[model samples]
Target: MNELSDNEALMMESLARGIAVRAMKDHGAVPPTVLIGNENTVIEYASEALADAAAKDRLAQIARLLATANDATVVTTILESWARIAKVPGGPMTERIEAVMIMTEHRLGSRALLLKIERTEHGKFRRLTPVSVPGLDSVQGRFTGLIPPRSPSPEEIKQARTVLGLLGLSPDGKTIRHDLN
Candidate 1:
């Protein structure tokens, strides 16, 4: 697959932010408190595929502390450790893992407090909003409040059929023939 271009990356970040904000609202989590609790879960799950013995051992220790202690220090250490691990140099998989951790940090680090809107050309407005999702730095403007048309009345349908028939189309719209001599 082709890598995301600048525009695509920006769009992806915007989507992530919107989704994260929605998730936080649904969970009733206040700003800076992510719904995905227990940082240790991240450490354990992220480290599960590691083949390095030292990394596994380190993860085991972090898991043990997370399982037993409510100490703020332990929690902070675990979070920081995961953050560092997320930065470990590797390939695409490693980059993805790091992105997850970065997103987690964003979600748990700030609360969206304001929405700013600006007018653009063509009677369109651009809205800039904050979101909680990782990697999604800014939410983009969207056109909203469009009302769908109601179903057409019988008279309207009949009129449409008449128009189609006049166009040399069958009532069922399956047959058409044109001849010039």
Candidate 2:
């Protein structure tokens, strides 16, 4: 993807900040930052800035938008319209798209999966976890070392389910089915 120019980055950041502010005011909670790009559209929202009740409500609103978005263009259009409504300056469309793609593909957020490391009781170290997100067909044994030792926290599990859901995987997390027909 194309790199974002300094001006474009500033514009995009401004637009995101504006949207977040508006969303916060309307719902009484800060909304997620949206990144738009081909194959990389995503909304990374943190709701803690507002009151606890407001934050949950705002997060739910953000999640709805994210869960329903199916394409990058749609996401960009939505953000552009939001900016216009909020009177925020818009960024270069192409740069926004590219940034979105990079963000989504890399999963750049607090929830993004970082490197997986494993330590054994015998002081041995192993790094056999797959770098890619797991699919339905991905065997549990392949990720035995990667899966969290205890059940994932609700938020973490929710994020995982969302990612898997975006990839069209089953909620059960057993296997991947590509047949959309």
Candidate 3:
């Protein structure tokens, strides 16, 4: 598949918002203007009631409270209160609630990349850093031993020959030749 373009990304964002709205409607959630924003773009879900000064003020207060919270637990607590105030019902609201819970959960390790720095003994010049590849965790059992062996069928061999031809491989499979003058 091809990579997603900017327009496709926007369309996907719209689809997600539509699904959220539908879920909210199904669960009888009070309709609040849903807003999705990034550093560059801001998309608003229009609602007549959300235009009120009191509602806007409350939203601002909630936003301020969230901004003050540095820890995940505090942030989750603030989000939960905000969701309650917004009158979010079951389905999509449940998803939002779970998201908040995940945000608050303890992470197993740091997501940031680690860097190692080295300095010369003479202190004349220093190199920036080097990175080591992380090792893969070991799996529990040997599942391959339990599985059955299989051989290529006639159709598979035919398809393989077609692919080889496309790659300019000889039909007899004797040698590989490169185009040259």
Candidate 4:
């Protein structure tokens, strides 16, 4: 796989995040999801395999599948996960932080984005903050060809904003508050 343009990488990341947010809204939790694309995207929900596979095994299976499928140049997997992270910049690590993990293997290599989130006492997920990790990019696509992508639809943006509202975020965050008050 060749490196992606800066714009292409950003677009892929945004789309993957939107898909995860929407899944959270639908399932009340992030289920393992896989999206494959060449010129079109096909979404596969891995909920059935969740019972049979551990997180590590599941990811490996996805990698193997992608590698064998010659046409699949991009693959993204999203799931609910726990992350151990520092509560302060250089302070004690939090034992467990609920998170959304999105891993993508694409034209420009790979990235796994972990967005830290919290479930309020009332059981609503709040906040979507990016966290840095050293080795999360372990899922590089071994694609021999780059998959050309179709243009993003306008509706995709609207749908993402809706998911953000569902997750209690504002667009710029002031005028579009997600609070019910």
Candidate 5:
């Protein structure tokens, strides 16, 4: 992956915060005061600030977005597009974003993984390791440690299942595996 310039990196952080804030507003969430903080600050702080202020419906919307994604690469690409549109750097995808992607992957397989994203450095994040569910493990463990725990609503799961099926994926035992893989 290409390394982003300092200015470009800051722009990406700002863009992410802007996206989060928009999501909040679109979902009727009363955004947290911290959202108005420095845009170049840590991404985790921005994500948490938006998350804290997000109404249950807003959170559900965000959760559903994460849940329906097919994989981390696709999720990363979606995130990259935002940065690309702003003509900013978007390398070394943030852990918080990765957390949402990985969480969605596991949740689609019916695993309840919970995680919290915390700020570390600017444009960076750290997530709490999710507790493993006994007898329920991902078949494609390609992104084990990167995943955060989160359970999707039944409706979200249904939608995700439809998406996965379209992508040629299906749950086998405790894991969701692609048929062609």
Candidate 6:
């Protein structure tokens, strides 16, 4: 497998975000979606099942399956998901936010894109108001941690070290970061 280019990763991000935002605006929600892009094609995956208690798990499973199947050569994958995020710092405030997690197995790098969303309120008689927040519904965004905590496996560590190396950091060293919420 060859290393994936930054352009490929950015393209995946753009495609996934567009799909997620369109879904959010049309349905007031984002269905868990995955877009796998390679040299000349893009494949999308999404479950048709209803969102239940296991929806998050189901989304992860879908993503893992796709990743495993195409592990050798897929350029990048953007896992678009609807998830809860801390609304405030260390105080238990949380809100549902939009997320897109990206990874590439060619060189095994990963990133997460989290977005806060705000919607316009309905006016009298459920009519739309003129105060609708402009494009993309008033979003604020930043990258987050390594997608949350669970001890990463040996393979995961190796991949991460490669990412660190890309940043000119010690390949076997790790650093702590406090993500912006």
Q: Who wins the TM-score comparison?
A: 4
In terms of TM-score, how similar is model 6 to the real structure? 0.48
Worst 10 residues of 6 by lDDT: 124-133
Candidate number with greatest lDDT = 4
Q: What lDDT score belongs to each candidate, Candidate 1 first? A: 0.29, 0.33, 0.28, 0.56, 0.30, 0.45
Residue 129 lDDT (model 3)? 28
Error of 5 at 127 (Å): 24
Q: Give the per-residue lDDT of model 4 (tens digit) for 124-168.
A: 766567777656666454221223343334564455445545544
Which regions of candidate 1 are displaced past 4 Å?
1-4, 29-181
Per-candidate TM-scores read 0.19, 0.25, 0.20, 0.59, 0.20, 0.48
lDDT of 1 by residue, 18-74 (tens): 543453345322122112123223211222333466655544443322222211111
Model 6 ranges off by over 4 Å: 1-4, 49-58, 68-106, 123-181
Candidate 6's error at 125, in angstroms? 18
TM-score of 1: 0.19
Error of 3 at 154 (Å): 68
TM-score of 5: 0.20
Q: Over the stretch 1-181, how does candidate 3's per-residue lDDT look in tens digits?
A: 1233233334433444344335333532323332322223333332223455676554433322222221111111101112211123222323211111001111121111112222357542233222322321111121101111223355644665565455454333223577797
Compute the lDDT of residue 174 as modeled in candidate 6: 26
lDDT of 4: 0.56
Worst 10 residues of 3 by lDDT: 72-81
Model 6: how far is 128 from its true place, Å? 18
Per-candidate Cα RMSD to the true structure, in Å, reads 26.2, 21.1, 26.4, 13.6, 18.2, 14.8
